[model samples]
Target: MENRNRFPHPLFYLFPLYAIGLYFLVLGVINAYVFLAPISIAALMTMILLPVVRKFENWKINRFLSTFLATCLALSLYLSMFVVISLQANSIYENWDTVSGRVQNTVQKVQESISGISGVSPDKQLEILNIPPSALSSDSTNAVNSQKSEKDSTSKKGETKESTAKQNSGVKAAITNFLDFVGYSLLTFIYIFFFLFYRTKIRLSIVRFFPENQRDKTNKILNGSLSIAKQYLVGRLILIFFLWIIYSVGMAVSGIDSPILISLIAAALSLIPYVGTVIGYVIAMMMAVVSGGETGQYIGVSITYGLAQFVETYILEPFVVGDKVDLNPLVTIIVVVLGGLVWGVVGMVISIPLFGMLKILADQVTVLKPLGYFLGQDDMGSKDDDFLGAIAKKLKRMFK
Candidate 1:
């Protein structure tokens, strides 16, 4: 009788505070991501390569040397992949004139096909859409004339040749991005080396955050998180390889050019749930279009993608990746999109495993168990399910 309702439950009060704190903490992290991205990436890479470092350590190698060797091996493997892709890309670029002409011809055919469906030629459709056909023709003519005049003026001026403004801008941007990437990669390697060397101290530091009484639980959670992260990474690598083989064979059989390269790219893009598949399909479709394949070839590529995705989703992911993360469909989609918004594609690729680690910790902590459950793959009675059940019960009672 003494205002029991006003007092409510302790959890009812504390839960809100915990949730609010976590929200702000995440917001702060996202805001500071630019400064912290290197550290985060390094930590993730270290976790992935820690086993190799430990294996070397077990063989009585120096930790410093072991860490360096592990880092170098990982880097070399990735560099090899990059080199292969670069060679293929260079080959494509070297034949860009032919490729571009083929692409333009294919695109024109597509426009014609589209126009057929509307019973109007592409030019008539453009006119209907308030785009003058003559305007487009004039623009193309003007572009050609300008290029001729520019060459004449340059020859007259006896000046050294220079790339067009667009080409120069593209080259400058590409160089800038490449330099930034190299710098960040070096920083990440340094971080990985130190992280491997001080791995024990790092674990102890994390354990120290908890009370002495809870140190064991904290240690267990951390160790479990690391194991799960490693497992997830390995599973992803296997899945990528599997998809690559399947896709490459199919594309090659269908006579797609650069089958291996296209398959490798498409398989890698399968990391992000739902969205990645769409993007990969569009990319393959574009490649097929540009490769000058007939309609049958396009259908073959689409069918190949569809089958590979079906197997990947149903067989590979569930069985190979397993249920370690246990994230629900809704949570996975939301986390992927949020990761993309915060850190672009890299975020999307790494977000799931990181969230899985968070889910593991949440499950270990009593106050956060509900959040862990919510993020889980369980199909228990959700809020809407409960509401519907309640309404059904009320209707039954009224009828009775």
Candidate 2:
């Protein structure tokens, strides 16, 4: 037999390299945007609103008109809400003295209640808090002198510590915060323009990535991805509305002052994933605890939050959020944590959807298929239920 030369296919071999390189390139681009977070995020938001722009186009509106109208309307709504919340926050701060007093009394009461069964005296228990003596001795100093001394203490010591810490941290925080908000806003706006303008080209480009024979599959996946994104966003917004309703009802039922106002702020922030609502709860409880000297109400609020999350995860997610955007819980956790670490709150909120989109992309590419599988929602789990089930089925068939 004559010796024959056999060589590997170039594109076949290159496909793996292409996938790996493409992913890293994507990651690098994302990192640059993280560094330039605000504008980048703004661009992202604009992309998100591209569908809305298209909606206007269907009405025969000019792109510039639609873009300007949609963007301006969004900005106006946000600013108005921002002003209302800011005013309410300012009012709360103005009456902080009263709020502080009420909180202190409630804490003391809780401490006293806890301390009743303790071996230690209230004075000893005070260090740990939530356990203390029922009695608080009167100060030896006259009321006026005590008030003066307290003012000095609050000014010189209490504020100094917090202010110094914030000052040390504030420079980076302020820059990052400003950039985060403004940058994302601007980026999103720009992205919206480009996305809307090149929407057809983008769709065609995505389809062209596949071989002609598989274009149908690619088209299906692309449409599915976009549909899922829309579903996810709208569902999240719906969940936020539900969260606001739950929080507002709880606060109102508990008879907390400023329930409606605080609820409004909380509801607005609840749109942020995870940390946002927790921050809201802490603020809401603090307000309640301080304003009323009622520790029970604060505890109730915390309970309600826990219950709400439980319902959301088990009930709301399945029914309302839907199973279209399936992603591994582990991946979800990692993405959320890493995004928050790299870009803070905005990163955390969008990480899930972004990762979900990436998963869809990976599914379309063979070399990246392993990554898609890894990021999949299904797993064998620690117990290997699939293995056990297979064994049991085999055993039953054998016996029969």
Listed in order, each prediction's TM-score against the native is 0.82, 0.67
Query: Best by TM-score, which number?
Result: 1
> lDDT tens string, model 1, 27-146?
997888766788888888888899899899899999989999999997898788888788878878888877777776775686688888867888776767897554435457677657
Candidate 1 Cα errors over 4 Å, as ranges = 1-27, 127-166, 380-400
- Which regions of candidate 2 fall more than 4 Å away from where they truly are? 1-35, 119-222, 261-284, 293-296, 299-303, 310-316, 379-400
CA shift at 378, candidate 2, in angstroms?
A: 3.4
lDDT of 1: 0.83
